[model samples]
Target: MTATMRAVVLREPGPVENLTIEELPVPEPPPGWVRIKVRAFGLNRSELHTRLGLAEGVTFPRVPGIECVGTVDADPSGELVPGQQVAAILGGMGRTFDGGYAEYTVVPRTQIIPFRSDLPWEVLGAVPETLQTAYGSLTVGLDLRAGQSLLIRGGTSALGVVTAVLAKQMGATVLATTRREDRTAALAEIGVDHPIVDTGTVAEQVRRIVPEGVDAALELVGTPTLPDTLAATRVHGTVCFAGMLSNQWIVRDFYPIGYIPTGVRLTGYSGTSGNLPPEVLQDYLDKLADGRIEVPAPTVYALDDIRRAHADMESDQVIGKIVILPISGQR
Candidate 1:
């Protein structure tokens, strides 16, 4: 009999109930790949899309986790020693191949970033995908720099919080916005220079604060908000769409030729290997270990409770990252 491992499998792409714990064969790393003993992994909106059949070219009965932090159990190429600690994210992980929702997962050795960190499982697991998106959107998409002004269009979302922290750490003045007026106070505590209650007038509110608009904006909320994010940037500034928390992927009537202002660049950072660079994850981990940066503590669940975790994420109240620890009891 083949060796087996427990994984949260998506037998069919439908509702959250379709995700169930199943005993799956332990996967082996093919040539150029490495196998990891998944200690902890973070859930993202992309995985939800994969589960809903919204991710094109994705087949059913998949293991849907986009990223993880774990120990490299085997590396066939001898690039990384056995038992090496590593973090990996977004190299078609949960989309084209089995992913970290299992006790073990395999990826190309190039997908792994071997790192040394003493942080606990929940924290490490929570950082990879979140930090990758934030780092990529700010550094690459927005060309972020010190002394600039930034607007995070979805201040209460997980990505928004991390982006504010990182952009602040980089010496940028941050103005964050949320649909609820109450969350702005919380944003202020996290170094947000100004927080706007995201009424229908996000651009108008931001202009009141920064006058000429911000240097850049990170749009976490989807289509309904991207236009406003673009309008909130200064001439020649950029806007990067990094997440779709609104759950809407398409922007109807999007005529960029006329809609996007001249000299105001529009870019995006998908959480792919190209966006989530390995050195970027390493750099974030190093800062995490040294106390220079912080991520909200993860709300952990055993692999058994994976369904409930997803249900909660779909709700309006998930304040931080939700993590699954396979070694812990099933949810």
Candidate 2:
């Protein structure tokens, strides 16, 4: 008989209250898949957006975690040993398929990346989605180079901060912007060279540092802030749109010919298995293990308090990622 486990289930796209901790049947992985006994998982704004029906193509009665850290509980492929530690994400997790918002998540073998880390579950859980997105947007979308100047339009965001830290590691001069002046010091702590407060004229502040503007800009604030991000870039520089923190997706009044500067390139990136494959997840894990880059300790919550967790994330009060430990009583 199949066992049952604790899972945070979203019955519909409505409110945080829609997500409930329930006893669900343990999933048996299909052929070429494995069952992972989830230790921890990180939460994202995308998941929040999905719960509110903002994300398209998400079906109801869904599990909402996009990434997880756990052990291979059952691997029929014979490639992985039982109890082997691993991390899994991407491949339509929590979107098109059952995901990691549970005590056990059944994911495809192809999506699993063998990882061994001594770090606590919160830190490991925080690394997968954020690091994969940041790494892809920087290396794949922007192709960031050493000595170049980078402007992170939404620098105070979790992805923005991770990207800034990684860019600094790659020898880039990073300039960051935040709507709140209070976040300036925090941004600076993560190696942002210039933490400017944006007051409708972020380009002006950016131009103050580099007369022609920075070499590249990553637009994490979405279409509402895309113009300013583009304006903050040098003539030949690139601007990548990776997030929609402004909660705006389409440009209402778009004039591509006029809005786009001469010789400047605009690119949009979304992280997925095709763009951020499982092997890349392993690469990021290796980096974390070796201290090449670090993910901050996540603000943790019990799986039972998931409703409060969603409220906290939507409040925009928390700075870093929030983690969910399915085993609520354990530390």
- Give the number of the best model, judged by lDDT: 2
lDDT of the structure predicted as candidate 1: 0.84
RMSD after CA superposition, every candidate: 2.1, 1.9
- Candidate 2 global Cα RMSD: 1.9
Question: Model 1 Cα displacement at 196 (Å)?
Answer: 1.8
What tens digits encode model 2's per-residue C-alpha lDDT throughout 1-331?
3489989889898877899888989998888999998999988888988888998888878988788989899888889998898888878789888899999999888777787767778777887888888889999889999999999988877888889988998899999888899999988888899999988569988998999989989998888778888888988899999988767779877788898988899998886645656666666667777877664557899898899988988876677688889976655
Give all TM-scores, in the order shown: 0.94, 0.94
TM-score of 2: 0.94
Error of 1 at 51 (Å): 1.7
Give the alpha-carbon lDDT of every model: 0.84, 0.85
